[model samples]
Target: MTQTDWPSKVTARVADALRARRKELGLSAQDVTDACAALGYPIPRTVIANLESGRRASVDVAELLVLAEVLGVPPITMLFPLGTAPTIEVLPGREVSMWDAVAWVTGESREEAMKTPTQTVLNMFREHGILVSVAMLSRELGEEKRREAALARDPEHRAKFLDMVAELDRIHARDIQSLRNWRARMRELEVVPPALPDEFAYLESSETAQ
Candidate 1:
């Protein structure tokens, strides 16, 4: 097909996926319309019907977002339908795997050449946030173990609980070190990392003391 025809083909693909998903969920056109209304964006039943039947030539961005929410699928899943369609013409005369299409659209493609410095920094911050969560959880777990050890009546049980607490403390310490290292890298990149939570405030204080 010519480049000019690609837009219509994309609309057709999305239309078919929407029809299949609505049917799979046993929802009628009116049901979708009601859902859109509930979401504060009213899409008429006739509009939904027209889109599904290929009577509508284009899908509005707002309509697509609301419909995807009502259909209980990611917006990208509605457009790509990965499992059902193995590949898509992401561009005119350029067919690629459905997964690649998704990655390109989301700016998360694995190709190094496709990655910009801004994307790299975003990814770094994302990873750092995950490490911070892990460290927070580890610290909380250690606190729980300490409390359990204190409440144990039997000496043997208390000893076992104390051992567990020690292990948890070791884990928390390791996690905290990891967070410190991650923050250091962020600073090296000339990016100011987000402030640590109250529980982790000592990390910053310790650095200041050093």
Candidate 2:
């Protein structure tokens, strides 16, 4: 009996999309290699073929980002099919990023789409509780990988990631409101946002999202 050797879900999804996209464009492995050369990446045809075949087990974030940009596929498509949104298991009583909510919806529908904030402002309501900045958030995400490794070793540790994401998301929501509210508050402070000296003179919300 042959035991199944399963790839990571993300890798499998990416491989499927690569194959589908190549077929849809009627492009061969050599064609992709040539296009990549023109675009200045110049990856070999065998590399393209290997990735498409799921023989490439790992890709760094930068490489994946470049591949998505080159292939005309959104980065998330390589993680999961875009037609249905992934289930967002939100803990009660927390504000999630509007973009993340939209992402979850898009994932459920599995559509290739994105939403971006005009600006995101974050708040840390308590000492030792708030990630101080976006820089801090990035650091926390990095730390979470270490946490994830620990969790992998102990099944009980995994739930912490979900909780951490929820907490971080709340801080991000506060930040979004912070950016929006800054204009009104700046007048009180006798200061103006550098982007616009004449406050409320030029404010246009993203029409694609609320």
Candidate 3:
């Protein structure tokens, strides 16, 4: 395909995927039109039919977003059609695996070494969020275990509950330290990390005090 043909090829691929997904969901072209209207985009039934029949050679970005929402699929899925297609012509002459195309489109690198500085920062913040959630869950679990220990009539059961609480405490402390270290790395990158959640507000307060 010529470089100029890539645009039409992409549009045709998306159109075919849209038709397939709509049929799989037992929706007619009119159904899609109504759904788009409900979403405030108001794509006409004739437009949907034209797109599916290849009478239309182009799709607007707004139409693509609305259609994907109406079809209950990610917008990228319509563009890339992974699983159904092994590879996609991401460019005129650059055909790659559907998964690789997806990774490129989403700004995700399969190899950590290939990640850009922005991707690294995004991943660091994502990891930091997970650590925050783990720390919060551990703190809650510890409190629940402590309460169970207090209510236990059997001395052995109470001891076991207390041990679990201790383990949870260790987990929470480890997560907190990991979060602090992540924030430190963000600072080193000259990027201001997001403020910690209330459950971890003490980490910042203590650091300020020191």
Candidate 4:
């Protein structure tokens, strides 16, 4: 579909991106014209005017990258977004969607998957905020001894660790309807909020040094 056929946000996002690029690069609209020429795209001032005013929308990824390179920014920042983009921080590794969390855990042995302290940290960030403290996780974990076997390192213990991890992996993998079911069940049972798992908490001082 043409720019004229795209979503309104696409047009607004495009305009905001280009306007920001121009400001950051210290470029006039004419400078974009020169850079576009060097890249063989050659967007004219009037074309830019239309784009910035939302009369047309959408630019190709490669074209966006070429403009970003000429304008001196990352390609994503040119059209999608950067660190502050809407869906970035809530998604692990700054992905575009929540499903990325599932993909990361798929088919992995429970032991390896639980070891992703990063994913757990990201969950905390999503539920709370990026700055959620380790102390919060620590307190919750300390209260759930049965759910969280000791953090051990014997090779034999690793198997047990993985078994515990499998249960957790299942919980986090719940789809929206499953989560809704769980919430309803909890309400019916009048259960308190469950504790966060251990091993999901911060590294011990020893773990941190590594």
Per model, how many backbone clashes are there?
0, 17, 0, 0
Best by TM-score: 1
Best by lDDT: 3
TM-score of each: 0.73, 0.40, 0.72, 0.37
Model 4 TM-score relative to the real fold: 0.37
Candidate 3 whole-model C-alpha lDDT, 0 to 1:
0.88
lDDT string for model 1 (45-137, tens) is 899888888888888788889989999989998778888778889899999999999998777888787789877877888888899999989
Which rank order by TM-score, best down to worst?
Answer: 1, 3, 2, 4
Off by over 4 Å in 2: 1-7, 84-210
What are the C-alpha RMSDs, in order, of all predicted structures? 4.3, 22.1, 4.1, 17.9
Q: Per-residue CA lDDT of candidate 4, range 21-122, in tens?
A: 788778888888888888887777787777777776566666666667777766544444544443433222344432332334332224454656555444
Order of candidate numbers by lDDT, starting with the best: 3, 1, 2, 4
- Residue 100 in candidate 1, Cα distance off native in Å: 1.2
Model 3 Cα lDDT, one tens digit per residue, 26-145 = 999999999999999999989999999999989989999999999999999989988877888988899888998988877775856658887877778888888888888988999999
**What RMSD does model 3 have?**
4.1
Worst 10 residues of 1 by lDDT: 201-210
